[model samples]
Target: MSKLLARIAGYLSNRTLVGVDKLGNRYFTRTEEIDGIMKEKRCVIFKGEGDPTSISVEWICWLNGQRKRAPTAEEQMELEARREPVKQNVAFLKQEEEERRAKEGSSHKAKSTGKTGGPDLKSFIHQFPTEGNKLEEESDAVDRGRGEDEAGAQKAKEPLSE
Candidate 1:
C-alpha cells in the first residue's frame, strides 16, 4: 500500500535509494531533464519520529545540490582522523600551561623558608659581565669617575691665574 501511495505521489517516478546515514535516514536520487540540462534531484526520508531539523548537514548539502552525492563512510572516517590530532594538541598545551602555573606557585611557597635549593636567583644576576669571582667593574684599572682626592690634587697642581 505504501508503494502504491508513493507512486501516486510522484515521488517514485524515477527515484532510487543511494545511501543511508548512521541514524538510518534514507537518501534518494532521481535523474530528470530540466531546461535541457540533465539534473539529479536529491532528497532524504528521515528515520523515526522527530523534527526534520535533526537531519545532518552533510545530507542537507546533498539534498540542496551543493554536493554531488551523500557523504561516504570513508569521508566521515577521514574527518575524524584529521580532527583527532588537533584535539590532542589542544589538550597537551592546556596540560603544559597548568604545570607552569603549579611550578610558579610552588616557587613562591619555597621562598618563605629561605631554602636556597631551587630556581630562586636575583633577576639582575646575569645583567652584568663576570669572569670567575670578579665582575668587569672591579677588574677595571682606570677609575673613570675621578675620586674626591684626585680632584683636590689636580686643583692644587693648577697654576693661579690673574
Candidate 2:
C-alpha cells in the first residue's frame, strides 16, 4: 500500500499543465517530486504576462521546466523591451501637420502673387548694398510713412455719422 501511494504521489508530482490566454500570456504549473518519490506539492514553471505570439510554445514549455531550455538574462531583457508600452499623442501630431500645411500654402500663394515685391525683394537688396546712403534711408522712411498713411486713408474713407 505504501509503494502504491508513493507511485501515485510521484506520478502526480511529475505531471505538468499549461494555460494560455488570447493575448499570448501563459501560465504553467507542475507537480514536484523528490528522490523519485512524488510529493503533494505543485510548482510554477513559468508565469509570464505579454503577447504570447512573441514567445513560442516550445519556449514556454522550457520556461515551465517541462523542456530543457533555460531563459537567459539577455533573453528576458529583450522580451521586456518588446513588451514595453508605447506612448503616442496622435491629436497633437495631427495638429502640427495641419499647421505646417497651412504655412506652406500661404507661402506658395505669396510667391505666386506679385504682392510683397515677389522674389526680386531678395536680390535687389543684395545688388544695392546699403553704404551710408541717405537716399536709401529716406526711401525706407518714406515707405514706412506711406504704409501708415494708407492705413489712415482707409480709416478716413469709412462713413461718418453726426
Candidate 3:
C-alpha cells in the first residue's frame, strides 16, 4: 500500500536522536519538505512491547509538539528526587490524621452527632413531611370539597311540594 511505503520511506529518512526515556524508548525528529514548506516530524521507537503508557508526561509533550525541547536526563532525575520527599510527607500526614481520628472516634463516640461534630441536618429534615406527602394531602382536601359541592347541587335541584 502507498501508506506502508510512505512509512518505510519515513523510517529510512535521516532523523536526529532527541532523547531516550528511562524506559529505554528512543525519540527522534526529522525535517521534510511538504507542500513547498519544511515541516518537522517526530516519532518514538519503543524499546520493547511498544506500550504507549510507558511514555512519561515530558516525553509525551515533546512527541505531541507541546514542548519545544525534549526533557533532559538531569531534569528528570531532579524531578524524581523532589517527588520522593513529597510522597514521604504525604504518607506521614495521612498516618498522623488516621491516628487522631481513631482517638477521637473512641473517646467522643456519643458526643459526635455527625462527621462534622454538629447536629445531623439530614435526620432533622426527615422529621418533616416531604413535598410529595404535602401534595397528596392537598389533593385529598380538594376531592372532599368536590363531594360536598355535588351533594349541595343535588339538593338545589330538588323541587318544594307546598
Candidate 4:
C-alpha cells in the first residue's frame, strides 16, 4: 500500500525485492508497530538495485523477534527498588523549598515590624494612632472652650442686670 511504502521509506534510504512473481511482488519483510500491534509487512523502497536498506530491514525484523515479554514479579520489585533514589531526591528538594519559604516569611515579617532579629507583633501595633484616645482628646478640648468668649462679651455689655 502507498501508506506502507511511505512508512518504510522513513526508516530506510534504499530497498530491494527479495523475491517477486506473477501473483504479487513480495519485497523483503520489516517489522513495525501498527496501532500498538507489532506486525511484519513487506517494504518497498525507491532506491536502485543491491540497496543496503533491505539487509537493514532484515536485521530490524530479527531484533523485533528477539524481544521478550514483560518482567516477572522479582524483576518488578527490583525496578521499584531502583526508583527509591529518585523518590528521595524529590523529597529532599521539597523539604528545602519549605524551609526556604519559612525563612523568607519570617524575614519579611521582621522587616515590616522594624525588628532587628525577628518579627514582634506587639511593637508594630504601637506605631498606629488609636481612634478612642484621639476622639476623647478632641471632645475635651472643645468642651473646655465652649461659649467662654460670648460669656465675657455679654457680661461687659450689661449694665448691672441685677
Candidate 5:
C-alpha cells in the first residue's frame, strides 16, 4: 500500500527508488542543488515500524554516506562472519572477569577504594612492587640498619627534659 504511494510520490517529486531492503524499507534519492552544488538528496521511508534502528548497519552506512551504495550479499556475509569473533571475544572476556571476581579478595569484590576516598593502597602497592617505589625501599633499608634498640638509645642521647 505504502510502497505504491511511495512510487507515485517518487515520480511526482523526481526522486528515484534507489534500493529496497528485505524488510521492505525503501531508500529513495534525487539530485538537488544545495548552496549551488548539485548533491544527491537521500532518505528512507520505513515500511512497518518506521524506527531508525530497524535499518541494517549496512543500510545505515549507505544512508550516512559511509558507503557508495547498499551492501552486497557478499559484504553482508563477510560482516556476519566478522561479528562471530567479536561476539566470542566479548563472551570470553565476561567469563574471565567473572572468574577473576570469584577469586578476588572480598574487599576488592566490593569497592576498590578505602573509606578515605583514596585508592586501595594494598592492591596498588602489590601490583606495582617496591622496585618502582625506591623511596619506600630506602626507608625500609634505613630502618633495618638502625635497630629498634639503637633507635631508642639515639633518642635517649638527646638532651634531658627540664
Candidate 6:
C-alpha cells in the first residue's frame, strides 16, 4: 500500500502534460532518476478505449523519441489541411484511371470478333525460315568466314617467313 501510494505521489508530482492530439488523447513526459542518471519517460493516455491505431504519425514519432518535441496544434492542423488536397488528388486520379480502363475495356469488347481459337502458329512460323536449318546455316557461314580469314592471314605470314 505504501509502494502504491509512493507511485501515485511520484506520478502526480513528476508527470508533465506534453500535448493533446486531435482525438483527445493526452501525451505526457516525466523525468526520473534511474541508475543515478536522469531519464525522460513518455506515455499516452488514450481518450477512450485505448486503440493504438488512433494515434497519429507525428504523435507516434514524439512518443517513440524520434522527435525531440511534441507537435503543436497549429502544425497538426496545417498537416491535416495539406493532406486533404492530396487525398482529393489521389481520388481524382483513381477515378480517371477507372474511366480510362472502362473505355479501353469497351473498345476491346467491340473490336474482338467472337472467333476464339489460338493464334495461327503455322502462319507465324511461315514468316521465318525453318528454325533448326536457319541456326545451323548461320553457324556454318560464320565458321567459313573465320576459316577464310585465318587462311588468308596464314598465307600472308608464309611469305614473310621466307
- Can you tell me which runs of candidate 4 are displaced by over 4 Å? 1-68, 109-162
Instruction: After the best TM-score superposition of candidate 5, give how far the Cα of residue 14 lies from its true spot, in angstroms.
Output: 2.6
Per-residue lDDT of candidate 5, residues 33-135 (tens digit): 9899999878899998888888889989898888887676677678878988999999999999988787785546555554666565796667555667777
Off by over 4 Å in 3: 1-16, 30-41, 49-54, 94-148, 154-162
TM-score of 4: 0.26
lDDT of each: 0.78, 0.60, 0.89, 0.59, 0.82, 0.92
Q: In model 2, where is the ten-residue run with the lowest total lDDT? A: 41-50
lDDT-wise, the better of 4 and 6 is 6
lDDT of 1 by residue, 1-162 (tens): 998897787663788888887688888898899999998888788789755787767778888888875799787567767878999999999999889878988888533566557785566777665667556566453464567669989989999897
lDDT score of model 3?
A: 0.89
For candidate 6, which ten residues in a row score worst on lDDT? 106-115
Candidate 1, position 8, lDDT: 81
Question: What local lDDT does model 2 show for residue 103?
Answer: 96
Least lDDT summed over 10 consecutive residues: which range in candidate 3? Answer: 110-119
Estimate the lDDT of model 6: 0.92
Task: TM-score for candidate 3, please give it.
Answer: 0.49
Task: Tell me the tens digit of each residue's lDDT in model 2 across 5-34.
Answer: 988886776455444433344444455567
Q: Candidate 2 — which residues are off by over 4 angstroms?
A: 1-59, 63-67, 85-162
Q: Which one wins on TM-score?
A: 6
Ranking by TM-score: 6, 5, 3, 1, 4, 2
TM-score of each: 0.39, 0.19, 0.49, 0.26, 0.50, 0.53
